[model samples]
Target: MQDKLSKFEKAALLLLMLLAGIFGGLIRYFHLKYGFDALGLAVRGNRHAVILAALFALITLAFAVVIVLALTGRLFPKDAVAVGTIGAPTILLSALSALAAAVGTIVTLASAVKQLSVWGMLNGILFFAAAILTVPVVRKLSVRSDSASPIGTASLIIVFWSCFRLIEVYRTVSSTPSVSVYFYDLAALISLILMFFGCAGYLYGRSGAMRVYLTVAAYLFFGTVSLVGKGGLCLSALFSGAPVAMANVTDVCVYLYGFLFALAVIPTFFAPRRADPVAELIQAAAEPEESGKEEPPVL
Candidate 1:
């Protein structure tokens, strides 16, 4: 394979990717707090907010198109990255995110822990059960251990996106549909699709690992930004003595899933240091009938 990108092009691309991440994180923060349509009629309609929404919509749609095209076998991203195994930094981040999330959960529930209802119990059970099932994701990244099954990961991804983001999008569209809300609807739907692909790709760990990494990063970035954006709206409403558009439990779960995606990134980037397992995965991915031959790593 040839490295076609000039140094400047590569640098520019990295910067753009980083910016996208920052913006997405902001949106996630807000979205989690203010709930669906929090950014729709009130925010997206504002002239200043237009720039924010426009940038996010552009990023979401752009990545969505690329991933969809690639999935359909029509095109693939040009930039090449070879991730051979999961790394310590990724595991550390994952651990930190999970621990922080746990502490946050306990604190929030402390006030009402004794009055927990069936809904709360079910939600907690479902959330923790899903988290437990994904434990092997990062743990096995270093050794190419098949402890985490793709099907399990897929189920979790689909369930979360469907139950949370997709339903929220639906509720947004159910109301009066402005141009901005329509745009929001489309962006939300596309992002859910991207999230699904990104999560599924993490377990594949063969070729296109860099693509998986970028997709997962983009998904988490969007998730983070949405949560932050909603939080911004909710806090303002709280101070002004207005009803806050908050879904505390659900929003936290969504944020934790974003963190999970961040952890899954470990396997997407760092491959096993040994080539044997890498070769086996690649062979199975690329050609099962052909003789097992090692292909040079992508640089």
Candidate 2:
């Protein structure tokens, strides 16, 4: 069982690394196609800001890789590090991603309000709150022995948000959606479906396969959507000679959320199973009591 679990962890880690590479490649391709500077100035229009953000993202990814390696015993001996130590990076990453999302939502909401788009403002606010709340839940999951509840809850929230965003984009593009935008929508829809099943499996504490499936699906779709959207924006900006919109910045932040969430949930998939208290309680209640023994007082 331990060996099988270790294999799964390694596989998941490899998939994540591959996805990360693909995402980075797409970003670079867009920059090159758009004739952006090394700092993505043409795309973001703020060299210093883009540079800083890019640096931060790189650091975060590196940290994530290190944590996963340590957890897998690739960076150290099998017993050298505690699981909690491996989990620390996940907590930090979650907090940082949540912070980024919150900031992006605020910036986006302000702009939307200025334009008097009620729906936009509402969506931004809703997503903002959801993103912020995810931090504490993820933090709790990291240190706690039993993570099913938090995992299920987070999965549901993310699925809802993804579906909401998908619908909003679909409505906006109903008239004449571009191929690239349609790809983005498809990615969001895929993520929603995967997360739904993932959440269900976690809540039920069954279907380990479903959990792994969701992890891969989430990571793949997350990378794909971000790449499609950002790549499209870069291409458009290139042709139009316009700077990247603040919306693109927001998208970057949103992309980080997916990456962080994937990292946060991976360990849970490999964790050893424990007895469910509720199940134990139900069994105890159902069992027949000894005829001669006095019944214990109910708590």
Candidate 3:
């Protein structure tokens, strides 16, 4: 039954991902050719090539925030708030990365760094911090068998892996005396370990970390792959005019991949599971009986 549900989830998530990719492709294609000046963004040079970068970032942030909010109770559904406890720090982590990006973009131009290394590295730091900050919430929700654990884990894992380009940034900034190689190395190590634990949790039916790991790992691995490939193309497009077509094509493919990934993930989040309601009820029933028996019988 678990296997059956896993299979169904895989199929459904694939469809969700496929649709997202298709939508991404169409939107990117149009934006690259016509531009998104109305939305306060201009698709010039590599910017056109990386329109999908923003798309991926937006999707990831949205998913992460939603999951974190659900777990921490900041965004609980209906009147469910009084039932369980939620954490505030986790809620803040959910919202901070997006906030950082928005503020960073507004205050600092992308050109502040001569190399994509700096920008990429900063993103990695933000992502890692975001992921680490979420662990408490994910653990909290998961331990309680709440629905939000998988999402929380996934969000953190995704954030952790999505920062892969940080390696490149690390290499780039290695020469600068001010940059701490040790700091980044430590961060990288920590992220990888968390990612592994997250995946392990999922495979073992430890839904708290597993859900997070699966969601995060899928997004991180695929997202980083797509972004790294396209980020390079975007750089090329910025310098050369004729490669615009190639860049747009790359953008489309990335979108398609991302879309397919989403489709695959969403359903896993919903797939039916082997829940033991009877077992749960029995356990609950037994606990009280044991407690009452432990107390002195009515004097």
Q: Compared with the true structure, what per-residue lDDT tens digits does model 1 show for residues 97-209?
A: 55544543453344235556444444444445444434454454344333456653544544463354455545546675345433443443355456545445545544344
lDDT (0 to 1) per candidate: 0.50, 0.54, 0.42
Please give each candidate's TM-score. Answer: 0.58, 0.57, 0.32
Which candidate gets the maximum lDDT versus the true structure?
2
Q: Give the candidate number with the greatest TM-score.
A: 1
**Per-residue lDDT value at 170 in model 3:** 56
Question: Model 2 over residues 36-97: C-alpha lDDT tens digits?
Answer: 45543344464433443474367346745665666455754353211222255556777776
lDDT of 3 by residue, 147-240 (tens): 3454545554543543443454456546654222123222323343444455335433454533442344344433433334444446557578
Q: What's the candidate order when arranged by decreasing lDDT?
A: 2, 1, 3
- Residue 112, model 3: lDDT of 32
- Which scores greater on lDDT, model 2 or model 3? 2
Clashes of each: 29, 0, 20
Q: Lowest lDDT 10-mer window, candidate 1? A: 1-10
Q: Which prediction has more favorable TM-score, 1 or 3? A: 1
